[model samples]
Target chain A: MSRESIVNAALFALLIAVPLGALATDEPFIITLATRAVILALAAVGLNIALGIGGLVSLGHAAYFGIGGYAMGILAFHAQSYTPLFEGPFVIEGTKLMPIIWLVAICGGALAAFVIGLLSLRTTGVYFIMITLAFGQMFYFFTISWPAYGGEDGLSIYVRNSFPGLNTLVPIQFYAVCFVLLCAVLWFNARLARAPFGLALNAARQVPHRVEAIGLDPVRLKLVALVISGAVTGLAGALFADLNRFVSPTMFSWQMSGELMVFIILGGTGRLFGPVAGAMLFVLLEYLLGGISDYWLAFLGALLLLVVLYGRGGLVGIFAGKARNHD
Target chain B: MTEPVLSTHALTKRFGALVANEAVSLDLRPGEVHALIGPNGAGKSTLVGQICGAIKPDEGRVQFLGRDVTEQSTRTRARSGLGRTFQISALAMEDSVLQNVVLGAMGAAGTVWHFLRPAMKDLTIRQKAEQALERVGLSDLASLRTGEISHGQRRRLEVAVALTLSPKAFVMDEPMAGLGAEGTRELTALLDELRQEAPILLVEHDMDVVFSLADRITVLNYGRVIATGSTAEIRSDPEVRRAYLGEES
Candidate 1:
């Protein structure tokens, strides 16, 4: 195996070992922190598909993330209250089933992404970034003002959602679910990176006209990438809401969108486990440095500058190697 | 007469007040190199853009294999076998040479949407890309990143990409540009062979290569066809001599 493969393997091992060790030591909070890292990494992985492979720098991903969080909150809220989601329209009932919530979250995120992508993709570079940020802010204000599902104060579920054959209330059990989902998404991302769709998307990112001259529509490719990315990030949002037993308009804030991008940049933009490494590092720094000062983000900004200037690739690039042959 | 593989009729394009191309018509017949030569600011690229569906004409129609494709997207025309190479090499610099060719093969096969199977391992796409690379004498450089390759190799790689389309006609924009004498000689020979696979509409500044390879010559001056003839006829035409060849020769 190549050095990158070895590093990826080791990273996965460390991710698993940390949580399991936390479980043994009865550090439920540490396990919760690990779960947060996994979910954030999962969200970053979604952004990586568009930002890394497709070369789209979207700044509105929190809209999808918030949609997912609200998807979980609304459904479980209705299920707990014994009220139909709507009086008419075939009497849609809210259910706390994890799989169903996940399905709803994915579809919600994907549908929103399709509509947003259609409009945002018309502009590119800095304009595209501004448009996405605008969309994110739009969602943030809408959620705060709506007031139907707790609005700005946010909604909270008294108990975590249910998963069959496991008590999700247990920190280790919940972490396992998020871990497995992260692994599956990572595997899917890896497969996509090698697939024909990925090859065209990568080429489109580098030279769109070259892709067009060879008979592929670059915009369509990017739209699909954005949709997939949104769906994955949405799933992570659902898990994040469940982990905290809370959902908020803050989930849709622009800062959350920027944080997801940070995870990818810190790890390595296009590397398979770059999001994972970046997320873990971000969490580790938060845990370690959040105690030291209220301005930990200033340090992060400095580090991000260093990565942008000299590091070129990020943590994975430093530890493993530059990706050879688009690996 | 054999039907022309590609043609444009009364193609005109305007940028506000200035007209880039006006009433320009051209055709490439089967198994022939139809060379388009003109001096700078002559609107050859503009006319080419119209034919390749990159530029929309204010007035005109582009027909490929007899179908009017004036409104088709650039990719649709490309997929319909209107292969083109850029004047400047437009290639995926980050992709390996094989991956770049494979991308073209994937485009030609219309299998770019296939999401599960690894693209490089797909035998059909791999073989087509390999065959195109072999045709351009670039099989040995297939594994190298495209950016790291020499200028001449990138030019040939461009031809390889177009070839994977299984083109009915080629719209080449200065395929000989930036090549050394030996590189130019090699590409000239390869392009001569490529005509047997598909007719070529060549745009070039190299008069010797143009004269040697062109079965027919169309000269453009200010977006208008100044002359259309064989090597002997164009060589003797006073208008062509005064407009273009006089300054260079």
Candidate 2:
């Protein structure tokens, strides 16, 4: 195995061992923290599909994340309140099943991403970033204005959603759910990085005109990547909402989008488990530093500056040495 | 008297007030390198762009393989077997030399949408990429990072990428730019053999390579084709001399 692959394996092992160790110590809180890292990492993995592989640099991924959160919130709210989502059209019922909510979140996120991509993909570089940020802010305000599901204050779930055999209320069980999903996504990401689509997307990102000259549509590739990225992030948003048992407009905030980007940069862009490593560090820093002072974000800012200046590939790059490049 | 593989009829492009190309007609017959030569700012790039579907002509038709493709996208034209190389080295510098060719093969096969299967493991793409690399004599350097390759190798790599498309015609823009004498000689020899695979519409500034390799030559000036004839005829043409060759020789 290569050095990077070895590093990746060690990272996965450490992630798996964390919650297991927390469980042994009877610290359910640590398990919850691990779950938070896993979910955040999952969301970052979604963003990395566009940002790292596709070189989209989207600044508005929170739109998809918010959509996922709202999908879960609105459904669970209706299910608990014993109300129909739609009475006149066809009596659409709400579902508290985790699978159903996740599917809805994915579809919703994909649809939103498709529309946003259509408009934003027309522009590139910083303009693409601005347009996506605009779309994200648009979603944010739309949620705030439309108060049917509590709007800015957000929606609250009476209980956590259900799986077939697991009590998701247990911290370790929920962590397992998030952890398994993260692993599945990481696998999918690795496969995508080696796939023809991944090759085309990476080429498109580097030299769009070169890709076009070679008979591949760069914009179309980026659009597909954005849609897939959004869908995955949406799934994470649903899980996040479930963990908190609440959904709010804060999920769609620009800061949330920035945080997702931070995770990728911190771990390593394009690396399969970059988000996992980044999220682990982020959560750990938040917990450890938040205990000391309220100026934790300042410390993060300094660290990010250091990484951007000296750490070319972030934490994973430092561990794995030089980038693998073509892999 | 054989039909041209690619032809442009009175192609014109206007950038506001400046006429980049005006009523420029050209053709690339099978098994010939039809050189498009001009001094700097003679609209050679613009005319080439119109032929390659990168720039739309204000009023004209571009026929390829007996079909009118004036309205086609650059990618559509390329996938239909119109290969192209840029003046500057437009490569994925971060990728390995072999990966660049594989990307081209994948594009040629229209398999870029295949998301589950690994590209390297695909025998067809890998084989095609290897073949193209071998053709360019870049097989030994296939694993090297493209950015680290010699300037001449990058230009050959560009041709290798275009070759993966199995092109019926090539629209090469200044492929000889920035190459030394020895490098240019090697590339000229390679391009000579390439004409058997596909006719080339070559836009170049190197008169020696053009005089040596081109079967026919088209000279342009002020966005217009001043002369189109055999290389000897073009070399002696008075208007061609006055407009372009006057500065060179």
Candidate 3:
């Protein structure tokens, strides 16, 4: 195996062993922390596709992330209240089943991403970034103004959603579910990074006119990447809402989107597990620093500055050595 | 009686008041290098852009492989067998040479959309890209970072990129720019061989290489085609001598 793979393997082992050991010791709080790390990592992985490979610096991914959250929130809220989502010949009932919520979340996220990308993909660079940011703000304010699912207050779930053959109420069991989903996403991401689409997308990021001269449509490739990115982040959003047993308009906030981008850059922009490492560090920092002082964001900002300046590659560069240019 | 592999008729493009190309027409027939040459600000780049689909013409048509493709995108025209090389090396600087060539091979026929299997695992794209690299004598440098290669090698890589498209005609923009005498001679030999694979629409500033390789030459000045004829024919044209050939120091 390559040096990077060895590092990746070690990271995965540490992640697995820590949570399993916590489960044995009956530390529900530790398991919860692990779950939060995995979910945020999952969300960042989605963003990494567009940012790292497609070179799309989307500032509005939280639109999809929050759509996923709202999908779960609205579905579970209706299920708890025994209310139909819409009045029609066929009543649309809310569901507490995890699979159903996940489907709804993916669909919602993908649809939002498609629409946003359609309009935003026309412009590039800072314009693209601003348009995406505008979309996120649009969703954020729309959710805040709409009164249906608690408006700005947000909806609350009475219980965590159900999965087949598992008691999700148990913290470790729920963590296992999220962990498994994260692993699946990681696998899918690795496959994509090596695939033709990924290669074309990566090349397009570096040189779009070259890609076009070679007969591939760079915008089309980016659009597809955006939809997939949105779907994955949306899934993470659904899980986050379940973990909190609540979903708020704050899920759609711009800060939430910036935080996701932060995870990628903090860990390493292009590396597969960068988000995992970044999220772990971020959560730990938040907790450790919060205990010391409430001005933890200042510290995060400082660290981000350092990474951008000297530690250009983030945590992965420190561990795996420098990656070659293809990444 | 055969149709030209690539042809543009009365193609016109305007940027507000400046006419970049006006009633420009040219033909790239099979097995010949049709060189487009002019002084700076003479609109050669603009005319090439119109033929390559990078710049949309305000009026007239571009026919490629006997089809009217004036409205098609650069990508559409390319996938349909019109290839292009940029004036500046427009390579993915971070990728390996093989990966860069693979991009050229993979873009056509919708094979670029394959998202599950690794591209290297697929023998077809790898083999084809390698073959293109071999044609340009770049197979040995396949694993090298494209940015690290010498300028001559990068220009050859550009040719290799277009070669993978198996083009019926090629639009090469200043492929000979910035090359030394030796590099220019080596590339000229390569183009001599390449014209058999596809007719080339070469835009170049190097007069010697243009005279040696081009089967025919077209001179442009201020977005208008001043003359189109054999190399000997253009060398003797009075208007060409006054407008461009004399201006070349």
Name the lDDT value of residue A108 in candidate 1. 93
Candidate 1 clash pair list: none
- The lDDT of model 3 is 0.90
User: Candidate 1 at B6: error in angstroms?
Assistant: 1.1
Q: How would the docking of model 1 be graded?
A: high
lDDT of 1 by residue, A5-51 (tens): 99899999998899989888899999999999999999999999999
Q: Give candidate 1's error at residue A139 in angstroms.
A: 0.6
Q: All predictions: root-mean-square deviation over Cα?
A: 1.1, 1.2, 1.5
Pick the lDDT winner: 1
Which pairs clash in the backbone of model 2? Answer: none
Query: Candidate 3, residues B62-105: lDDT per residue as tens digits?
Result: 99998999999998898899889999999988888999988888
Q: Candidate 3 - CAPRI tier? A: medium
The 10 consecutive residues of candidate 2 chain A with the worst lDDT sum are A318-327
What tens-digit string does per-residue lDDT give for candidate 2 at A114-167? 999999999998999999999999999999999799978999998999987999
Scoring the B chain of model 3 against the true B chain gives a TM-score of: 0.97
Second chain TM-score, each model: 0.98, 0.98, 0.97
